[model samples]
Target: MRSSVAVILATFHLLLFSGFCNGGTVGICYGRNADDLPTPDKAVQLIKSQNIKYARIYDSNIQVIKAFANTGIELVIGIPNSDLLPFSQFQSNADTWLRNSVLPYYPATKINFITVGAEVTEAPNNVSAMLVPAMQNVFTALRKAGLHRRIKVSSTHSLGVLSRSFPPSAGAFNSKHAFFLRPMLEFLAENDSPFMVDVYPYYAYADSSSNVSLDYALFESSSEVIDPNTGLLYTNMLDAQIDAINYALMGLNFKTIKIMITETGWPSKGSPNETGATPDNAQTYNTNLIRHIVNDGGTPAKPGVAMDAYVFSLFNENRKPGLDSERNWGVFFPDQTSVYNLDFTGRGVVARPPDANNTTISNGTSWCIAVMGASEADLQHGLDWACGSGNVDCTPIQPKQPCFEPDNLASHASYAFNSYYQQNGASEVACAFGGAGFRTSKNPSYDSCIYATFGANGTTAAAGNATALSSAKPSSSTAASSGSDFGVPTRGVAFFVIASVVALLLYL
Candidate 1:
């Protein structure tokens, strides 16, 4: 018995560790190009309130750095392209900038990466030539301070750096940027830093909607596209984009270097020509992206490798000089109210406040349905919580129950999540099972299994006017972005239960 218990315990711990390792990091980009943005202190508070663990800023603003001190959020600071020339010409300039900008708050602020420049290849006056030198000088300053290993040095690049990205396997860096890019790639590889690039599947689809499907770009594709050269299957555009970068890196014989998404997001609003840039699309893309990364849904080229990404702009910067989409990538408005519901933790859908007007569900009535693409593990977590602590009446989902046929985790979880939501007043908060549940106006009732809903007399019922409700389904297509199922492995759950019992016995 003791040996069996020990084995069970070991298995439980291994599962837990593997799950942790597989969940990649998600961070937000803090751009302050707006005139009406909140102060740094308030911004930090807002970030923390959302349970966000990481953030990246455009420049080394002292006020912003100071505000993040003692907050425990991992920060990535930057250097503008204009400063690259001065920093490259003189090592002392780099040292001085570091001293004034980073040295004081560092360990307290949890500063992780120092981006030397932003898209230097796109900058005027051939500033790209100075990128590597600037990075080297900054790295040297950190080394002198005994902080080289603690703070990584790299630069951010746009997808334009790649000359070709179609089919992903054919990705290659532009020869025009070869002189500087090669050396920079070498520096990144040698120092064990990631090749940071801004990947926007929105652009790929927006520029050529005829060739690229919105479903593929938003991670909602029920179909897969096979890369002919590598024969690797691509379910989403983001994965294809990253793999293209990976192939580009491998072509240079830099296989060991990792890739990071410095900036990526969809706009809630855009110009008339910027097709598919609606609030619904933005919400779907970002929400699914968080789930993809946190669930370790790596690209087809590197399926096992975990990737980290920072969503562009925490707040919409109205002053940004570009298309209207550029000003609307922010997840939250300046007032700190989210532009739409988003769960930063990648667990379940975040519930919007009652007063908020961005919800997709109609004001009349709503039902909580299991989001289509939620992973099996996520669905299980939500289901367990709903049936257990959520005080949901899950009797209808058991064997011999009306809802048991079609017998799958998705159907069962939907019934339970909806039951909980209806019983608890059908508020958005009740439906939020960590991004696992979404509110829908369409009735999910079939044959004998009727989903519970709040009645007119303020009571919950298992029956409702199925046809009277809206004919449109929930954002099922958008939720299908992950294409994840609702089945949890039974062996893992059994191990967890056994381990728990053994732990309690030992404690007694």
Candidate 2:
């Protein structure tokens, strides 16, 4: 009985922690193949300012690794294709590389993954054969340093390795690449590492725009494509592409391994022949992609399975040898200004129309509050920014203070957001929060907890609108649907708590 209880408790804990660890996450690829880009230290600041928690660098540049030390940003570093042969031929080479490139600044740098080679199947001089050997050598070296379990060792592949990805269900690996891919998949499964791949819906649509609808590629599709074999309805091309990879993995009986999108993005500019590459399309794709990932909008094949992806990339590389679109995939320019405004937090819509003076303005009386269904993580991000960097006085929402009764994420976030909004002259940009907040004409004051409003004189109490606000209370639909108080339990925390109790009872 004790053994059975122990097993049950172990499984319960695994399930509990796995859910938290695997929650949908977004990372940016820090590709520095440009002449005028900011230095690594400045780049770190830029990433933090945007609330970006994860970043991937193509190589283990000492300067870049040093810059990330103690910044709390998880990094995915890489090994170039040229080094694969030496790493594969001798374990000592891998050990030396790790000692010089990684070991000295590991835990401080937060290096989560070390990709052995990127897209080896596409590399020249038949490097695909060396991919698995290189990964094994790297893993062995890390194990020698007692770091194998902490930093995952793997390689990234391009979609060119797949023979067919149509309808998603019929996905399969190309026969030629299977020799290396099979062992690689087995290694990933055995070590609990993710199968990294670069997925580009933009390439698919750009290559065959006649067949792929712009709406589908942009995640704006109203219709769905039903897979005849599995009856899975795919609403967007990105999900379908991921599901296709999932199906391919399943075909090889590697169902335990998860997929990580190492790179995915749309370009803001392109050659005339490039059908759908434009600033608007790029913005729409990335914005929707962030929203989808952060919301845990899993593909139909793996519903509710939170996946992590890295957007490519942080800045456009002027020296990249390709079409104009190739050099224009960045969300930001070298100057640190956004190529276009993006909400890295994926909380709210990120559309800002500036006036003639290039400043955001508000037309009428509006209050910025947390959106009804915003995720707890997103709400917390917005709240932290509002109180800290946003320079909002968040005293009223603290313990034993006004507006502290509800004591929930939504309520506190609403208070903080409104405070920031009112202080910032009620500009539309002030309420953006990457889409976590919305401008509501409805006054959200109730009882002693009063929201502030911007006035010609200065900040003023919203009590003047009390009579009008009485009829307009924030809806409790989100809380009721979620079976939590004020929608506070996010990402299935309540469910995990209940499961924990049941497991404890069984153990007792």
Candidate 3:
């Protein structure tokens, strides 16, 4: 009996370890704005195939919620901005919406959260005023249904909530929105819901290239920007964005509220003069950024806590308004082809074989992530050798963690040409080796890539600025290892791309 109990207990422990929040999480916001998009059922298949555990859709599309049944993907549904008045004015409306729209989907679908509004503070006029009341009413209705504990209430915001973000330590929320932001912060803090921010480093860089270096914004260069007030230095834009949020909460004395990035991405395509929109820069930005998150160093403001990020979008939103970049934030194209590359634990599934290696580009680089089968032992091995810790065998086999591409490196010209060749029946040579993935052909315009970033030590990032001199590109012989490795070669000519980027940095 004792032995049997031990076995049962061990099994239970294993289950809990797997079920409990053990570590890093990868997710996406499935925004279906285009008319020609696939059905929700097909969408579910795509998300699940990519191993994405969390998804945030703009609305509570019943079809989407129903399709996710038994799939075990966590969801954060939303209440459209238009529903605010009715939801806030009548508790009954909130209850009915829950009963009709949510209750039918219940535990079967794993509806973990409901965003009451999106960027209310950033919204014009009284929209900001109505958000909190609606959120509260929604909370009450969920409680009456006894679903409050199971489902958290929250909202997403834009970085415009912060009045000043330059010196991260000195971050502060705009005073105009404080009336609503304060109580909302308290409610979230008490309820254990995270504060979400729709942060786009690309926008900051695109709007002000004179002030924002492409490498610093894309996690490539190590130019430090100091906040005159806080006396803190920020090496990258993402880190600065997070620090701005942290400082804002601290400024409000809501320092304990969890900060979650709801949206952040680099556009794969954009208008000319959008200085850093090239594929090489896009890959480098995302590749290095992913590497930053997979490891221990949280934002400099929140050390020890693993950062939680949902790469802005799963697909390019062709229908979205605004400039060209607005519609190009997807990691993949509408047909489910990856736009750039991403090297990390998180990778999206491709419906067909790409012609070459790819990356999770946000619009500035062309990096490659490791193949999905990468393990921590492999990562540690790479880190050991790369950092001169002397643990890696430095063998010619696959690397443990995903490596990055140099800032201006062009693994492929543009996808249009590759697609042309693929359509013409030349798929083999079309697959080139590089960051995040091996795809047919990539657009010359987009170079941003996403790859793994591991800390040399448990506490600090592996010397920020992946394109720095310390990060040398491997040789060409190694670069052409095999077109089949969807991930890039961490040991060849690709490695020196970082060195070249660093050489460029010296001149910068």
Candidate 4:
């Protein structure tokens, strides 16, 4: 009898888990706009521990892509607004960007979506004119890479895309934006991509509290707001906002196009004016929202068709611009630690806010994992590369890949310096900040390059430059050795005289 009960309990456990593992799950958006946050690669581990399967990042951060690789988290990457015009005009440029930024960190990071632009139609402050053309160019590049189907192309919009959202049925784009938005919607429909939105009921409520009921905004009371046209009573504000988006699509004559909520969440804390931002409200809103999504209940407008939602963010960004509520919407803190009691419905997040107010990096030469003491000649070669002398050349991070000029050389140089300064934790963050031109930057990751090429005892430097490199000196810290390296820490040997001096002083 005991054995039978045990077997029955085990079968029930499997059945309960089967649906969650097999079916599609909603993803969380981990926006990295903060000044202090862990490198993207490390962040991936945090998300995995939470059992998060999907994510969407604003731009293609190399660190983010490299970190998510092999982590089984599906990513939806974006191109910043600035790149739209140039990228639209040059397919080759897009290709090069992909090879340098996207290609290296593939399969390991299952990047699923390529967001073309952000709310181009209502982009009063951005290059709204280049919106469609940029989309076309990015789409073309995906096709050339033969990744069009596997990786989609779309854009997220602010609900402002609609001229009138209150009535739902009376929705339409402003005539000024119609020329761009109509064609864009047509493309999305033909391509089968979602019209993503960055929806926030908090914004509406904050904009006007007297009119928008706090209970409706918080999803608290049982009261409802009916859509004037559909007469569908909305018990919560978020659904009403979503239905407004659906009606906007319908008015454009592409009713079949799918709509997705790319960003949404309630802030845990905020200023006095942001009344709906209380902890109780946050719990009510998020708890109810998750339950809403879990139930897979569609809005009255599109009943039964499960909506795709990506929670606004993973961490509260201290550096974000706008109201206090803007930065307080994160589900986690800078350290990948959860801010509240979010269950993740069976998931969790871990984070390490990268050092803040850090200007100079730790001495990198001290950080090298040393190789066995090499001959005098080898040391000389390594020194030459470390100091940036000419003639030495080692394999770049990307092997066998033709190199392309980075977006800006000066920026890359600064990044290379910072990356080495931060050493162990900031490799990916440095790369993302460094952009594609990172290695070639004047302050290049010359030391790291050399370390990778030679042995950690700084073997590769000698191979890259014929002359002396300036930075890769021996020191106290060391990189963890990869493959066969000399036994001693490279830093210890390089700074032998200095170490001895410090030791003598301490003893005295």
Highest-scoring model, lDDT: 1
lDDT of 3 by residue, 377-409 (tens): 543343333324322222212233222222111
Q: Cα lDDT for residue 133, model 2?
A: 94
Order of all candidates by TM-score, from best down to worst?
A: 1, 2, 3, 4
Index of the highest-TM-score prediction? 1
Local distance difference test scores for all models: 0.81, 0.81, 0.62, 0.60
Per-candidate TM-score against the hidden true structure? 0.73, 0.73, 0.67, 0.62
lDDT by residue for model 2 (75-152), tens: 999999999889999999999999999989988999999998999878767899899999999999999999999999
lDDT of 4 by residue, 123-155 (tens): 656677777787877777778878777877888
> Could you tell me how far off, in angstroms, the CA of residue 44 lies in candidate 3 after the best superposition?
1.5
Please report how far candidate 1 places residue 177 from its true position, in Å. 1.1
State in Å the error of residue 290, model 1.
Answer: 0.4
Question: Worst ten-residue run, lDDT, model 4?
Answer: 475-484
Clashing pairs in 2: 347-435, 347-436, 348-434, 348-435, 348-436, 349-435
lDDT by residue for model 1 over 314-418, one digit each (tens)? 999999988999899999999887786676766443232222333465577678877755778988999999989988778878898767754567777888888
* Model 3: lowest-lDDT 10 consecutive positions: 407-416
In model 4, where do residues sit more than 4 Å from their true spots? Answer: 1-24, 121-124, 346-508
